[model samples]
Target: MIRIACLIVMMMAGMLRAEVDARPDARVAARDAAQRLDAAARQMDKATTAKDRVKALSETVHAYEDGLDAMRDGLRRATVQEQRISRELKAREIEISRLLGVLQSIGAAPAPATLLHPDGPVGTARAGMVLADIMPGVNSEAASLRAQFEEVTTLRLLQKSATETLQKGLVGAQEARTALSQAVADRTDLPRRFTADPVRTAILIASTETLEGFASGLSQITDAEGGAPLPDISHRQGTLPLPVQGQVLRRAGEADAAGIQRPGIVMATRPQALVTTPTAATIRYRGPLLDYGNVMILEPQTGLLLVLAGLDVVYGHAGEVLPAGAPVGLMAGDPALSGEILQETPAGMGIGSGNRRSETLYIEIRQDNTPVDPELWFETDKDD
Candidate 1:
C-alpha cells in the first residue's frame, strides 16, 4: 500500500510537469516572425515600380514590427518562466539534497547488503518491496529537477540573444521606412480627380474655424464639378480596416482627458507607423488645419468624406486619386531606439500600452458635411 501511494505521487508529479510544458513555445513564435521579416525584405528588393516598392517596404515595416513584438513577448515569457523555475528549485533545495545523499548511500552499499536484512529472508523480502515502491518516486523527482535546470539555462540564453534580434529588427524597420518615404515621393501613377487651388484652399482655411465648416466648404477649393466616381464601398460599412495599426484610444463622442469631446475616433499608434488608405479615395486636402496637427481629408465617394488627422508627414497631393492601401501618411513621433525598447518593454510586453503606441491618429467620417462616428464604418475589433 505504501508502494502504491508512492507510485501515485510519481504519476501526479509527471502530470503536473506535463501541464507546465504544454504552453506554446515562445522561441518558435519569435523565429517565425523573423522569417517573415526576411521574406518581406526580399520582396522589397525585388520591387520594380514606385508603387510596388512602397507596398513591399510597407510589408517589411509590418514584418519588423511583428518580429519585435514577438521578441518582446518571448523574452517576457522566458523571464517569467525562468523565475518560476528558480523559485521551485529553491523551494525543493533541501529535498533534493536529501535525495542525492540517499542515492549515494544506496550506491555505496554492497550488493548483498542492499538485498538482505539481518533478520533473514522474511525481513529481506519486506525491505525489497519498500525499495521497489519508493524508487520510482525518487527517480521521477530527480528527472523533474534536471528538466527544470535545463529549462532555466535555455531561458537565460534566450534573454541574452534577444538584444541582437531586437537591434536587427529596429535597423531593418528604419531602412524600410526611409525607402517607403522615398517611394511615396517618387510615385506619380495614381489618377487625379482634380488639381487643388492653393489660393482657394488658403482662403477656405482662413474662413473656417471648425472641422465642420471646413469640410462643408471643401468643394470650393477645386473647380471640378463632377469628377470620376470613386468605387462604391457602401456595402463595406462597418468592416473597413483602420488606416494604421493601433488600438482605439477613444470612441466617437467619448470625452478626452480634458473632458473635451469630438465626433471622431482616436487611435493610439506606434511612432512613425505607416498610415494607408482603407479604400480608393481622392485627396481633398493635406496639411495642418486648426488645432489638428497634420491632416489628410479624403473623399471616398460623392457626399462622403473620411478625415484622418495627427500625421507627421502627409503623402500624395490634393486631387490625387489613391487605390486602397496606398501610403497616405505616417503617424508623428520618432521610433524608439532598440536599446530603449529592450530596457522599457520588459515590464510592458504588449503593443497596446502607451509606451508602445505613443502617437494618436484621429479619424472622423462625414456624410454630406455632417460628422458621424468612425466606429460605424471601421472594423475596430481587429486590434483587439
Candidate 2:
C-alpha cells in the first residue's frame, strides 16, 4: 500500500512539472507572431506605387488577422487548462475534507498514518498521496498561467499597432488617388480654331498708321496756343502708315445679319504694346457703342478722334496724346456672330467684290465730316 501511494504521488508531481515548463514555449510563439505582423505592417507603409501598396496592405491585413486568431486560440487553450486544473484542485480539496471528517469521528489526529486505518485500503492510501502531490503542481500551474496571460496581453497590443498602421496606409493611398485624378482633369485641353483670314485683315489694318506722324500730330494738338501747327505733310506723303494695328477682328462700319455693327478697330495685346502719350492730350471715356463691348475715346487734337474698344484695361486720361501702335486693350470675339467679319469689296471698282472671300477691315476715311472709302486713300499693295 505504501508503494502504490508513492507511485501515485510521483505521477501527479510529473504532470505539474510538465504544465509549468510548457508556458515559456507559448510566450515565445506569441512574440514571434507579433514580430511577423509588425514587419508586414511596416512594409505596407513603405509601398508607394498603387498596385504594390494594395498588395502590401492586403498582406498586412491577412497577417494581423492570422496573428490575432493564433493568439486567441492560444488564450482559449490556456483558459481550458486553467479550468481543468481548478476543477482537479477542487476535487482533491473535497477528498481531503472527507478524510479529515473520518479522522474526527474516530477521535484521532489527521495524520499520514491515517492511510493505515482499517477503512483505508491501498486505494485510499494512494489517493491521499496523489492529493498531496497535486497541491504543489497546482501552485506551479497557477504561476505559469499568469505568465501566459501577460504574453497574450502583449500580443494584443502589437495587434492594435499593426491595425493602426494599416489604416494610415489606406488613407494615404486614397489621398494620392484623389491628387492624381485632379491633376489629369486640370491638364485637359479645349478645342480651338485659328481663322487666318481675320488675322491677316487685322495685320493689314494695323500697318496703315505711322507712329512718328501720330506722335507729332498729338503733340501739336496739346500745345497752349489752342491751335497747333501741322507736321510737314510732304514728309508723310508716300510712306504707308500703320493704321489701327493692334488686333482688328471687326471694321468700323455697317452690320451683317447678326445686328452686330463693326467697330473702328479692335486690339488684344499686353500693356507693353501701348504707345507713350502726353498727359495733357490724354482722353478717357467708357460706354457701350456699336460692336465695341466697351469704348474709350481719346481725342488728342481737334479733328483727330482716337477710339479704343474691347478693352480689359485702359490707362489713358482725357486730353492726353498717345503715340501710334500703343496697346489699347484686349478684344474678344463678338457675342452676336462669334466675332466673325464678312470679307467683300464694294462693286463699283475694277476689282470684283464677290471674288473676295471675306472683308474683315471695315475702314472709312473721313475728311472734314465727309466719309470716303479708305481703299482710295490707302495704298493697297503695301506690305501687310
Candidate 3:
C-alpha cells in the first residue's frame, strides 16, 4: 500500500510539472498574438487602398480573435477544473471520516493484560482469534488512510495549478480586451472581397427558417469578389481547434433540452465565456432561430457549414470573413459568481446545468446538408 501511494504521488507530480513547463510557452504565444494585433490595427489605419485596408483588417481581426480565444480557453479549463477538484476533495473528506470512525471504534485504551496473556485454554483461543480479526481491520484502515492522503495531495497539486492558470488567463484577457476593442474599432468598411452582393439579399431574407436550407442557399451566393486569398478548409480537417473550451455534453443524434435530438454537440462551459472560430470560414448567417438565442453559421468550404448557437451577443455579421480563432460572440452569464449562481432551469433543459455549468453552446457540422460529428475535428484530452 505504501509503495502504491508513492507511485501515484510521483505520477501526479509529473503531471503538474508538465502543466507548469507548458504554461510559459503558451504565455509567449499569447503575447506575440497581441503584439501582431496592435501592429495590424496600425496598418489598417495607414493603408490608402480599400484592398490594403481590408487585408490589414483581416490580420488584425485574426490576431485579436486568436488571443482572446486562447485566453478564454485557459480561463474555462481552470475555472471548470475547480469544480472537479472540489469533488475530489469532497470524496477525500468522506474517506477521512470513515477512517476516523474506524479509529474511534477501536477505543483509546489499551487491551487489558488479562486478555493479552490469558492462561486458560478457552481464554487463549478466544484472545488469539480476537487479536487476528482486529489486527486485519486495523491494517486495512491504515492502508485506506494512506491511500486517501495521497489522493488529497494529488488534488491539491491540481488545485494550485488551476488557480495559477486562472490568474494568468484573467490577466491576459484584460490586456487582450483592450487591444481587441481598438483593432475592431479600426475596422470601418468591408473590403470589396467581403462586401454583400445586393442581388442575394432578397433570397437570403426569404430562407431563414431552416439552418440547412439557409446554409445551402447562402453558399450558392457570392459573398466575395475574386481578389482575396481564401483558405482550403477541407485540408484543415485534422488541424482545426475547438471554437470554445468546454466538455462535450452531447454528441450528434443525442437528445437535447427540448427532448428533441439533433445532429450536433452540446457543450457545457462557464457563463459569459467567449466563443471563437475553429478554422478560417466566412459568415453565412447570424441571428435568432426559434428557441435558440443568437446563432452564427460559418462556411469553411462550399458545402460544409459550421453552426454555432446559444450566444448572448454576436460580433461579426453575415458575408464577413472570419480567420481561424476569430472571436464571434460571448455566452450569456448571470451577474453572480459561480458559487452564487443558482439553478432555475426548466425540466429537460438541465443536462449539464450544475452550480458552475451555467452556459451551453450547441455546435453542428453539416457537409452538403448532412450532419456529422464534430468530435473528430478537434483535439481532446482523455479527461474531457
Candidate 4:
C-alpha cells in the first residue's frame, strides 16, 4: 500500500515538474514577441516626410498593440508558474512533515543518514529518498520563478518605453498636420490691392521739402552735440516741424487722391511752410528719381539716412552737412495753389488737391537700406 502511494506521489511530482519546464518556453516566446514589437515601434517613429509619418504612426500603433498582447500572455504564463510552485511547495511541506512524524514515532531523530538508510519498508524508504531528491528540484523551481519574475519586469519596461515613444510620435504628427492646415488657410485669404493717388504724392513732395528746412534749423541749434549737420529726415514724430499744420491728405502705402502706386508715408501741410532738417547729417542724394521728385538724401550719422522729396528748392547739396531743424528748403508754389496744379504738374510735383487742401510731405526712415515703417517708430502725438 505504501509503495503504491509513493508511486502515485512520484507521478504527481513528475507531472508538476513537466508543467513548470513547459512554462519557460511559453515565457520566452512572449518575451521575444514583446521585444520585437517595441523595436518596430521605435523604427516607425524615426521616419521622415508626410507619407513616412503616416506609415510610422500606423506601424507604431500596431507594434504597441502587439506588444501589449504578448505582455498579457507572458503574465498569464507567470501566473500559472506561480500557482504550480505554490501547489508543489505545499505538497513538499506535507511530505517533509510526514517523514518527521514517522521518525519521531519510531523513537528516532531525523537525520540525513537515517533518511538514506534502507532499514524501513521498501516503499517507506523510497519515499524518504524521493523527498530528499525533490528538495533540490524545489529549489530549481525557485530559480524558474525568479526567471519568470525577470521576464515580467523586462516586459513592463518595454511596454513603458514603447508607449512613451508612440506618444511623442503622435504629438509630432499632429503638429505637422496643424501647420499644413494653417498654410492652406493663409493661401486662401490674400491681401487686398490698393491704388495710389498722384495728388497725394504731390502733397507729400511739397511738405517733405518744407519739413527738411525746419529740420535744418533745429540741427543748427543742436549741432554742438553732434558731428555733422542734421539729416533731411525729421526726428519729430506725428506733427511736422512746419508752422502751418495741415491734415493728412492721404496715407502712405494706401489709396490716394489720384490713382497711383505710393510706397511711403505722406503728410500734408501748407505749401508755404519752410522745409527743415530733422537730424544732424550730410545730404547724401538729391534729385528726381522714380516716385520721389526733387529728392534729397541726407546722412545724419554713420547709419542714419534721411530722404526729403517734392521740394521747391534744395538748400543743401550732396555730402553737405546741415544743422537739425535748419531751413533746408521751401515747399514749391503758394499754399493755396496746391489743389489747382495737382493735374498740371508732373507725377511727383509739389501740387495736389483731391481729398483735402494741404501740402504733402513724403518722409521715409531707413536703417542699413531696410525701410522701417515710420508709423510704428514715430510717435502719434505732438513732438517734444
Q: Write the residue-wise lDDT of candidate 2 on 1-384 in tens digits.
A: 334433434444555456545544433444555555556456545533444343333334334434433443343343334444454455556433443353354346456554554665876767667656654544444454455445445544443443344343334333433333333233223211111233433343344263223322333333233234323232332343323323334334545668755433322322212222211233423333345444455443344444444443344333333344333332333222211112232311111111111213233333333433333333344234
Clashes of 4: 55
Q: Residue 283 CA error for candidate 4 (Å)?
A: 0.9
Q: Judged by lDDT relative to the true structure, which candidate is superior, 1 or 3?
A: 1
Quantify all predictions' global Cα lDDT against the true fold.
Answer: 0.77, 0.38, 0.57, 0.47
Candidate 1 runs further than 4 Å off: 1-19, 48-51, 108-123, 337-341, 344-355, 382-384
Error of 3 at 41 (Å): 22
TM-score for every candidate vs. truth? 0.86, 0.25, 0.52, 0.31
Off by over 4 Å in 2: 1-255, 259-291, 298-301, 332-366, 374-384
Best by lDDT: 1
Candidate 3's displacement at residue 258, Å, is: 2.9
Which sections of candidate 3 miss by over 4 Å?
A: 1-182, 188-192, 197-203, 220-224, 339-355, 381-384
Candidate with best TM-score: 1
Residue 220's lDDT within candidate 3 is 60
Distance from true location, Cα of 203 in model 3, Å:
5.7
* Tens-digit lDDT string for candidate 4 (1-384): 234334434444455456555656544755575575556545544543334343344334334434533544444444444445555555666554554454354345456554544556785578677666655554454454455446545544443443344344334333433333333233322221122233544444455554334333322222223333333344454443321134444444677667763544676654444456655556655556445566666665555556667765555444445445544555555533322322232211122223233456676666555555555444443231
Writing each residue's lDDT as its tens digit, candidate 3 over 1-384 gives 223333333334433334334433333333444454455445444433444443444444444434434433433343344344345446556544654564555455366643454467786677667655555555554564465455445434443443344344434433443444445556655433455565675567566677666666665666544546555566666567777766778877888668888878888766556678877777877777656788888878766788999988777766777766767776777523332312233311111222365689999898878888776666555244
lDDT of 4 at 178: 35
